[model samples]
Target: MTNDQRDPADRPRSWPYAAAAYVFAVVMVGTTLPTPLYGLYQEEIGFSSLMVTVIFAVYAAGVIAVLMVAGGVSDVLGRRPVLLAGLGCAAASALCFLFEGGLPLLFAGRVLSGFSAGLFTGTATVAVMELAPRHRRGRASFAATAANMLGLGCGPLLAGLLAQYAPWPLRLPYLVHLGLAAVATCLTLVLPETVRHAGPRPALRPRRPSVPAGTRSVFIPAALAAFAGFAMFGLFTSVAPSFMAQTLGVHNLAVSGLVVFLTFAASTVGQASLGGVPAERALPLGCFVLVAGLAAIGGSLLATSLALLVAGAVVAGVGQGLLFRAGLSAVSARAPADRRGETTSAFFVVAYLGISLPVVGVGALSLALGLRDAGLVFSACAMVLAGSIGIWLLRAVPRRPRPGA
Candidate 1:
């Protein structure tokens, strides 16, 4: 049978879907394991906090580079192959970290990890959605987001605990991840392929961030909202640990990781709360909540209050989670089916840009000013962006007609 005419029986099963989700989760966890370890690396390598942010930025750079070039390769080549390739990169990243003896090696390891995540982000989401049981697409979206958030949250938590209590702090965590990568690779091999393609493997091309025609109007507000939300996420992922250490006099890595994890876990909660809410309504509401969260975070930074910081993280994470799901669902729902993958990739490119660029700016600013001052600035800017988007979304997205009104 032709590619389009393949039997339905050959499609992926529920077990494979679950397996893929687990693999994606593992990869995400590995990427952020270094969060709690940055302080350790600082003592070992003698780099400044700015240098640490630079190192973190390198990872984001690697991810964007791969996304631009290979983001859509899975659409043509098949999800399993791309996923395996990602796992291979992830395994290599772990190995790089395991033996990292210097700053350059750290950069190299992080870059590889970023590339691995770049490959997985879009492919994994598509894989989970495609493999989900027909009746559970909504639930599957939650599962995918939850997996991403939980894995990210767990990374630091696991690393912090290990670093605090384990025999070999740096070496052991990556070694454990290497083992997980091996398992994920095996899972990828067994999972059924989803893409039905007949043409020869396409030559790799540069990945450009482009909105589909007619989507530009809606895409701008959505992308801006995403940028704002993810910028907040980037702050937590990249610098919040140091903030806890330097500003609040908190030196416990486990506690630091827990704070970061709470933000992401709360995001998972926010996303889950959208069961009955329409995407349009959720979009603006999410933005408003995000602004409040940003305000709280800024206040926490100014006051050096851990309670305020944690509260802000939880609130902002929820807003981000809600907006992300709503925005993605809206765009994906509107895109043409054939171009869905590309469009989705485009949306994420914007999201990840939000994750990287603004955080880099924060890093650069931290060099001139202090960390707390810089964080306050970053939080203020992000809040403004989110608030603007919320207002636009409110005006642009039509209110859903009430049932039997």
Candidate 2:
């Protein structure tokens, strides 16, 4: 149904929608809380740098697997239940981290975290939009997206500060998240469900992600932008801390976490800045900015300059923020309501692949080329991909026609 056709009762509840966003934010914060702690994990566990990426890759594996198999489950079962289940995953992940025994528990925690992220990434986003009034759709998108970045950024910052000053570096961060997750889980119980009709729940089955024929013009470029943007994300979240501590000689855990936080903060700013941008222009413009940011990252790595590195991260974050939000918003705008969930799943499947596969490749390359050189290589690859996406969006695809045009 069109926005006008939505049930009157479904009209956005501003406060409740904000509440849902907060719940989602809390869950995401758990996913990235370990960003700066990887170094400590490496030191305490006696693992190689390649092992670090492999551990992170395991988390991405869980996310990709869940996205493929169950990405549409919230639509089938009820948003709150699936979301609550996600919160459970978040809490379980925290517990895993709090009681980490060795590599095995660490792996388990990341996998559970991934499951939580995969469950919420698309599902929570759509739920927030669904809860918004017709006019607040844009704000809903912003709220969901910003909450994601905000939570993700905060996780590391909180962890970094606590790890730096607290008695139990590893245990306290996850402990704090456990409390937050419990609070979020309770808050989630009160969110009004957005899915209607109360039909028997569909069987949880994995459908191969598919893009409708005509939407490819918009979808492909959008997905490519997501890939390039997420590749940068993979770099920062997985290996950037190690890069700083080992190659750049910045060993402060708080500083490392702050750098990651800044990248996400820039992304939130970029997403917010898109409010006035016309739909057709936002995607390509975002692609161009992503390329520019990738170049800065490459320069930072080559020069071994911390300032340049942070600059690269901020620029990349902005581009990534713009690219992903614009891409998702555009894709959702063109989808038939019946198939919107499936289409969204497909978009994320591609996007998550971007996040994972290339990151693992960097890890493998780091084994041979070393971390700094490997990062430079990733930068070049992502820059080329980002540029190509921008060119394709500019030259080939027509804008999605306006509603009622």
Candidate 3:
């Protein structure tokens, strides 16, 4: 039987997929909840900017590790178990934050968040898409992807507001998430399973990520587009606050959160814009736009203009939104039916690496030359990489006939 052709017992009748999408979003929301609060952590723990990146990198390390070892387990054991494991890790992460005293707890919390997200990243997207009726696949895709970006966008905004206005700056946000996660866990319990397997439970083992035969050529450009876009995410989530404080003289946590929020919001707008353009066109164009956004960011640093910074973030976010969604959608379409999970996990490993490695490089550079110069180097390198991807796509991928005739 096909993956989507499940028995009636496993099929949810009334919007279970929608409910799952919300759960997916909430899980993702927890992953970035620390973005705006990193500044406060630095104050409480007395760490360098480099240490902050290290903390975030730990989260990415957990994510990549999970992607490698356990990412495809959902296909065998069942989605519910994998998702429950993810949520459990998320709750543990929240607890770590609630009791956070120093770097160890902080690192532990982020690593848990990473594991949670890695579990959810491919499973939730595939589950939501498969659960939908054939006619509603498009809307389900939107629900899945939108939930991700919107949830990520909401994380900092929620945290920033609570941290700025509420007591227990570090504690309250995670508390709220913990409550939400409890509710989500209950909901997940009732949601019908979408993957049906009749064999003994598959052993969990470390597996390498690979593309299906004939898909490797397409996979490269798609992975590259996702990498470039996620690099934008790494910058925004990791150091946008520092940029605002030291470079632009802005200290409002809410304002800083809003800046990060706008980038993801712009990404959603970019995804919404994908309707008119073909995937091939959208993918390459999105990369080009990402390069442009980085150029704007480079200019923003040189000028010390907050407005330009915001503009760059929004622009880059839109590009990221378009490129990533387009790339994933295209790659999914080409992946062999059975190995789809492996293929998607591989793509995400690249994307998450983008989010982790480049930001660490920037953090290292900051310790040496300073934030502004490091930012300039960061932007220049991003532009070079993004530009190369765009040019390669245009040349390697065949051009489609223009929309009309």
- Pick the lDDT winner: 3
The digit string of per-residue lDDT tens for model 1 on 220-273 reads: 777778888888888888888999999999888888889888988998999899
- lDDT string for model 2 (77-146, tens) is 7789999999999999999988887999999999999999999998898777777766677577788888
- Give the TM-score comparing model 1 with the true structure, all chains together: 0.93
Ranked by lDDT from best down, the candidates are 3, 2, 1
- Among all windows of 10 consecutive residues in model 3, the one with the lowest summed lDDT is 1-10
Listed in order, each prediction's TM-score against the native is: 0.93, 0.92, 0.94
Better of 2 and 3 by TM-score: 3
Q: Which is better, 1 or 2, measured by TM-score?
A: 1
After superposition, which runs of candidate 1 have C-alpha atoms over 4 Å from their true positions?
1-13, 135-138, 198-209, 399-405
Supply the TM-score for candidate 2. 0.92
lDDT of each: 0.84, 0.85, 0.87
Whole-model alpha-carbon lDDT for candidate 2: 0.85
Better lDDT candidate (2, 3): 3
Give the local distance difference test score of model 3: 0.87
